[model samples]
Target: MLLPRPLLVLDLDETPWHGELGEATQVTFALRPHLGFFLQAVAQAYDLAVWTAAGNDWLQAGLQAIKHETGVDLAAQAVFLWDRGRCTWRRDEAGALHFRKPARKFRARWLRARYPRERILAVDDLAANYACGYGHLVRVTPWTGAPDDTERLDLARYLLQIAPVPDLRALEKRGWRARL
Candidate 1:
């Protein structure tokens, strides 16, 4: 059989979980109701993983809770966990740990080399991620209102529709037309 679809290195920020600010809203904290179906639907074709600023425990519990709520076995297929790993935290010429890009370009580069997949993808909110030029990168707009987040989840589901993606560029291309 064909090699299993390449793993999806999903960023957990605004793409799946609420960003740092929405920590207070328990209802939305778990990406369960939002993207659980997307994950389950795609699991049939591709492996899943979480790479986010959220700590492992939170991400782990959230995954468990998602399966509890939606009855999907995501934990069984997790391929990696880059969340809370060493980030771009270093002093500059001035010796200040400031301006750390949310993601470690260096780390992404390493993963790209290590994972055997000819195709890889990342989903995040910030524009900086696109700078790395990974094959597949998806960004979620700031979730300011109820409809805003709901809409993001809807778009996320769409990506799962055509996974095992032959063309990484296709992920970005498919969602735009639906939004128009």
Candidate 2:
């Protein structure tokens, strides 16, 4: 019997894309190489969603561009999109907005009411984004849009490796990273 695909929540800015809006002086954007292939591979084995601390306008446009450039049809590949508006925000030490630690954004109470916690994973570059998801984080290195960057492809391999794992919670406590 085919089991339901696990839920995988992906962060957008700095994780998949290069720059974080509020932090970077000149925000440049590009689709990481192998992005389409990686998404397609994950979609075959996991339910995907995009969660970004960026604004809706930027997310929408970037998603559209990604779909157009990669022909991945992100709208179809991802089950949902969670933007800054949906996040619980706070100010950092410098008084700048910090929505990265949006543990509540996972809505554990609401989702757990319907789905199994073991089957939901959040992949992000910043560990802070997983304030309440330590048990579910697949921490990745931040994507810098370098020509040599292979984080997306590497993550696809790790996801595939762990996709068949029966109990994600029983795995290592440290975050999953691509073996260099």
- Report, for every candidate in turn, its global Cα lDDT versus the true structure: 0.56, 0.73
Best by lDDT: 2
What does candidate 1's lDDT look like per residue over 1-180, in tens digits? 454365666665555555333556444454523566667666666667766656676677666766777776656767766555533445669885532234334246556564443455665566554554534556556543344356545655655665655665444553442654
Where model 2 places Cα greater than 4 Å from the true spot, the runs are: 1-3, 19-28, 104-114, 173-180
Best by TM-score: 2
For all predictions, the C-alpha RMSD in Å is 5.3, 3.6
The TM-scores of all predictions, comma-separated, are 0.63, 0.83
- Model 2: lDDT to the true structure: 0.73
Collision pairs in model 2: none
TM-score of 1: 0.63
lDDT of 2 by residue, 30-110 (tens): 877788888888887787888888878788777876788778777676767888877766788999876654555555676
